[model samples]
Target: MAERIRTLTGHLVRHTGKKSPDVQNVSGNLSPAVQSSFRYTLENPLKTLTKNQRNFYEENGYLVIKYLVPVSALQSYRKRFAEICNGECTVPGLTVMKDVALAKSSPIQGEKAVVKIQDFQYDDALFQYCCLPQIIRYVENFTGPNIMAMHTMLINKPPDLGKKTSRHPVHQDLHYFPFRPADRIVCSWTAMEKVHRQNGCLVVVPGSHQGDLKPHSYPKWEGGVNKMYHGITNFDPTLPMVHLEMDPGDTVFFHPLLIHGSGTNRTDSFRKAISCHYASTDCHFIDIAGTSQENLAEEVIDLAVKRTGLPREDIQFKDIWTLKSRCVKGEQNHLQGY
Candidate 1:
């Protein structure tokens, strides 16, 4: 118990986030049953999920579909990533390493300074992977037949001596989204290579999505990225979390509301993963004002105001969602807005 407390405290200090005292208690000493219940897994063939697979996802908020992507597909992804790293790709969405001198001057240094290619779907290879037949079939289990690829990211975690930016603070995916019917929203996170505890693999709390969205805020880490997104500010310490260790082609389909994050890549090599957030066209955009969604919206809008020099009042939830969204599958329903 003391060791766990120390672990949590260390994570809190290093991550630049705050957790309420009550939330911390959840992680305190407890029996094995409590911890075991928090870790779960359901596996099925790559083509689609079985009946039990859907049940496990409903009960636990996540499903791990092994070998969903063939090795050849992963090889293609690797080639694309290599091209971006080697400066061979001039694609607009590829996030390139910035000038070393300028990057080093920032408060966050070393591996914590990893770059992410946002909306990499703009690239041909990634776009195909986003709509891969196997992936789409798995997503249909949650979103029915109508699915839209709402977000995509290729996160490159640089090796870190201190495991700093290599890890993300625990948070819910829906917090960053303005859409509703969260139950219909899912994420397919595919491991591009071997991912394990030492390489900062994802960690998630089972059944965390069964409740409403929780509060989130930026961690107070000094010298951190200025525009970083908010994360769960408080959580029950007792909630069991599993460190997702996967090999290439193993993908996890998860609920948007699940409390999840990753550790730092302690190894010498960089860890890469490609993920897409999918939502049903049946979902609708909701007004964030005067709602639980207000906090995150305010943070996002504030950044926009600073970046574009626009007034906060002029910004609407719909505007933000539209700017960040791209329809990859079915048509987007415009009428489902506040």
Candidate 2:
């Protein structure tokens, strides 16, 4: 059954090996809840964000920071990603190419035709962009001076043809994360090409991050695996959804709890974007039991079992999270680090 599932899904279950070189000592004696309250001092003033930008993000839960990357630099990244996808790059990373069988389903089912290249920052060219000093300062404005890039991805959203993958359901980023202090986590999404409603720009519900963590579930689809992504259950349509239409080099830093998702690409071209989740190393991962987090964790564990051909009972939630979590900057001082 596992072999058949692998044949059907063509999933790439690879692990990341990158670690933050500058190891720093952090207090490990504190409890998870107490550790979340810890804050780091910023090296500079609030120069990264103007008074108005600060007000907007505090009130709306997101900010669209324009010209974070130059178009020339983004174009180089675009070329590099394309080359990696074409097997021109020899560096090892998890690359999920477009699945033809899933794309040809009658009703257009399973995951979308989008290709997701995870942990591409291993490449020096891509690493430079992820650690751009100016951008890191902007991230420091929100997450403090001591920050770590927990997750990064190069997503190529293909055009829509009844493809469910092209259109992501409105969901909270916290659903996939096991860490605490949701306020300290931020995701920077940069457009590699001009993006608008036609090309599936991100749509986020303002002020959604201020609320509590909500339950999440997979949207009903034919032959779909949870895929470690869980969306908010029964998201209210009455809430306003803002379309984040942006040009190449434009980036948006959003809170983890913000309810956001992208629409299907109605145009013919692929919508490319590079994103990374920056988190405070001071925060710890609390044990989530009997909560929506545990529920989603189980969903992810099932997927991992199928992909690794491991028994469900043999896998623990912590093991799965430890595999996914990495420290991109500073040191990993959280529970997983020890």
Candidate 3:
């Protein structure tokens, strides 16, 4: 445990937006380095989680479980968040609603956020919240102890403000991240309250991780910016879209490539969630500059683009972390290799 903490501290000091391995997997194209890391991650996944975790990721691309954060932690976090927002506590580098991008220079297409804090050190709640034994167990069950906090933020959907809501554009986490050994990376989406439909519950296109990555535009929120899934309409209309109505402590594990977005917060209460991404120590970076990997690797098959049982263009993996997930007429999906 001490070694993991020490290594992660080193990683944190050197951390940038992307920290994947040099040989990474982006929709089945394998750089030799990524292949080795993939093998290592596979061999020790059970060491971090039970057999159930491996099965969970294989079937669902993520694990939606709990105990990642405790109720007391949430309460303390909520108070601190409020204090910062209200200007009662002032941090030298923190940004609040006052720093929102002015309407005169509105950079995005929707209502701006009320607060955006960057480089938020989790000394108070985040450390304890993220390092919980249950949470560590789940991660250990997969990637061993080589983990670091990628990023943190606060996106408050205050009902009184009636923030204009729209889909946050669908795209894989790898598109913007582009790290090596992409397969070892994981994300945890934890909620701060009851995330209901009216309160902007996150909607996910389950199993969409098996297909191609679509084009997208990112928006600047708080003090940070990230990719948003929009402009790409290449999904199977038949597959059921799922909305995760999560509670305060529940979190959703998902592949970075899954298709997901949230609706407007029409309800009276606030709905918020913290999404943190982690990866194994050996994740690699790829050499996409000169490989046939420009298109989805031949091994990473997409049911929609292949048109095996139906139309050929039905499935496709157009972007970095894409897959052909929509199979036809009760056909079984066997993700061969990527």
Off by over 4 Å in 2: 1-46, 90-114, 121-123, 163-165, 221-229, 309-315, 335-338
lDDT per residue (tens digit) for residues 1-54 in model 3: 234323323422222232122211112222223233233235442255456665
Summed backbone clashes in each candidate are 6, 1, 37
Q: Each candidate: what lDDT?
A: 0.66, 0.68, 0.48
| Candidate 1 deviation (Cα RMSD) | 14.2
The list of candidate 3 runs beyond 4 A from truth reads: 1-53, 89-118, 121-124, 160-163, 218-239, 285-338
- Weakest 10 consecutive residues, lDDT, candidate 2? 24-33
| Candidate that beats the other on lDDT, 2 or 3, i.e. the better one | 2
Which number leads on lDDT? 2
Please tell me which model should have the higher TM-score, number 1 or number 2. 2
Tens-digit lDDT track of model 2 for 223-276:
352254457788898998899999888999999988998877788777899888
Q: Write the residue-wise lDDT of candidate 1 on 1-338 in tens digits.
A: 23432332232122213211111111122122222232222222332566667668878899998989988988887778767656675553233443232366656643335456655544666656777877876776666555577777777777664527556778899888888788778999999899999998999998888978887778765535324546677656678899889999999999988999888667988788888898877788777778767876777667556555555566565564544444555446752211
Clashing pairs in 1: 16-219, 16-220, 26-237, 26-238, 27-237, 27-238
